[model samples]
Each structure stands twice: as structure tokens, then as C-alpha cells.
Target: MKKPTMTQTLLFILVIGIGLFYALKYGNKAKKDIAEFESKKETNTTTKEIIELKYFGEIDLNKTEEYIDVLTNINGNEISIDLNIIEETISKKTIQPTINFLENLHEIEKIAHKQVLSDFKNGNIVKDYIEHHIGEFNDDDLKSLGIKTTDSPKERKQKFLNKIYLKRIGFYPEEWDSLAIFDFTISRDLTQYLIVLSFDSNGKFVDIYTES
Candidate 1:
């Protein structure tokens, strides 16, 4: 076989060097792509897990607004007066008086009446109420909380109402007409309470949940 000339040897070395450089560059790119893909996979898994853990199925925008309207209209023309009475009663920890007032309003459904009365008689005020985001529970979690799964969303909401006492209403400063505020006491002893019933900008019951 004929030996390669010096120029041919140089060209061969250059080609090998170029090939090695490109191989390293492309290999590193592939590794980075794989890492990014894995990160995305993990993020998607976390999101799916969160969705599966949700208790509330979906928010009914129309129904949410309708409830707000019903509560507001039934409270009468003086929204501020109703709000003040509620806020004051809750702040003073006068549980029965508030229950009576709420009953008279006939706005929202009757709350955990017996428990509220018992708490008041027992000198409990639900002062330790905490906030929670909606869909923070699965079926198992609802069962644990003594909340049975209902066939329909309406039934589910009704069941939730039956378990808690609505004590306060904090209307958004400007958009009072478009909101539903429920500050609930969840335990007979007033130890467990839901600090806020959240709503999204679209008046959807998205983050509605109770905090222990």
C-alpha cells in the first residue's frame, strides 16, 4: 500500500479533530435535552397528582354568581348594615346571636346550628380558624372529615353547608355584588374552622375549602 503524503495526513488529522469536536458538542446537547425532558416529565407527574387529589370536581360559574346574588338580595338593600352586624357578632364571639341573625336573614342555608349553639354554650368561639385552598382533599380525605360523597355538585355543596357554621362575610372592597364570602366554623367545639371560602376572578368556586 502507498503511504499517505504529509498533506494527506494533516487533512486526515483535521477531519478527525472536527468530527471529535462536533461529537462532543452534539453529545452534550443530547444530554441537556434528556435532562429537560425528565424535568418536564416530573412536573407533569406532580400536576396530575394534584389534580387527582382534588375533591371538588369543577366550579359552576353561573351557580356561584346566582348564590351570591341570592344571598345579597335576600340581605336587602342595606349590604353594609348586614355586613357590619355579621362582622361585629363574629368579632365579639357571640355565637348564638349570630346564628339567630343568620337564620332570620334566610339568605344562605342554615349552618351547623346545633354545633354553633353548643360551642357558644361551651364558651368556644372558633378563634383558631385557618384558611385552606379548594380541592385540597380526595374522596378518602372527605370521608375522614365525615363528609360523604354526593352524586351531584349541588348535593355535595349542601352537605358541606350542613357541616359548618357561616359566621362572617368579607365583601371585596369594590365588587360586593360578584362575591360569596363564607367564614365557617367546622367543629362542634369550635376548634376546627374554615377561614375563607375563596373564589376566582370569574366568580368560580375554585379555591373553596375548609382549614382545620
Candidate 2:
């Protein structure tokens, strides 16, 4: 075999170096494009569907999983909340509603236990009669004051329904059932709330009574 001259070797080396540089640049660009394509594909694909009183739409449930990942950060297990009803309303509110309102309740309880206790005791709630009269609830029964259990057959659902409403609102008068339902509204100092006060197919609240 003939040994290559100095000039020939130098030119060959330069060509190989240029080829490697282009290969790396092209590989990186291809990777970026693949990432972008995957993100858009995930967003467009639908894996879930739900209906709400006001709005309903298909959602790509696991679409953003890649983008919004938690690294060694376990905040909490995913709670199965009715996202269809609350998602739009929560985004519109200055602060996310239900969770934020619950946070406020915690804060109030922290600062003034007496006031929180007084307010809670006097909290606006559904009348016991209404709750007991709800016919029947699938789950959730009033065990006692400020206590409810979601693991029961619960034939008489009226008072149970009322108690659940009361738990969400705080306290309500006995005559609240007689008055127009439009007057029923709940609020916390920190967050805006929208209580649908909805009923199930059997005229039961079905635990879908509260929204924020």
C-alpha cells in the first residue's frame, strides 16, 4: 500500500472533521424536532371525557406528563376531583377556588380558633330536613355534627344531603329550603366560589354539590 503524503493526510482530516460536525448538528436538530412533535401529539390526543352543567370537553389527561414532571418530588397523590366542572372556573378566579378556599379555612382556623369555631358553629348549611328528605344517597351519611362518612348505604338521604351542604357552607337556617335557591351562595375571604348545589339522577347531591 502507498503511504499518503502530508498534504493528502491534512485534506482528508479536514473533510472528516467537517462531516462529523454536520452529523452532530443534524442529530441535535432531529432530536429537538422529535421532542416538539411528541409534545404536540400528546396534547391533541384525547384519553378522557366528562360532562359538566355548563361545559364539557375531551381532555388529554396524560398529555403534559412529560413537560410537568416531578423529580424526586412527591407532593401528594393525585386526588380524583371533578376537573370538568371546576377547571374553567378555577382558572378564571384570581386564586384557584375550592383548594384555595379550603386553604383560607385552614388559615382562619390557625389565626383565631375562637372565631373560626364560632363561624363554623354558625356556618350557613342545608337544613336537616332537606338532607334527610333527599330520598337516598349512594354513599356519605351524617354521623354527627361536623362529621360525615362516605362509606354507607344511607337510605334516608335528605338530612345527609343537607349535612353535606352544611359541611361545605358552614351553617344554614332551617327555612333555607323554602326560599329561592338563587340566594344560596358561599364565599371565603380569599377565594370566589360557585356552589352548583346539583342533584344526581335520583335527586341526590351525589357529592357534586360544591364547586369553586
| Candidate 2 deviation (Cα RMSD) | 16.7
Query: Which candidate wins on lDDT?
Result: 1
| lDDT (Cα, tens digit) per residue for candidate 1, span 63-161 | 222112223433332221122222211212222233333334343323333333344345324221211311445676556555666546545544544
Across 37-149, the per-residue lDDT of candidate 2 in tens digits comes to: 99999977655523121111222322311111111211221211122222222222222232333234333222322322233345433333233323332223224322345
Predictions in order: lDDT: 0.42, 0.33
After superposing candidate 2, which stretches have Cα over 4 Å from the reference? Answer: 1-4, 52-86, 89-212
Candidate 2 local lDDT, residue 127: 31
How badly does each model clash, as a count of residue pairs?
A: 0, 13
Q: Every model's Cα RMSD, please?
A: 20.3, 16.7
Total clashes for model 1? 0
- lDDT of candidate model 1 versus the reference: 0.42
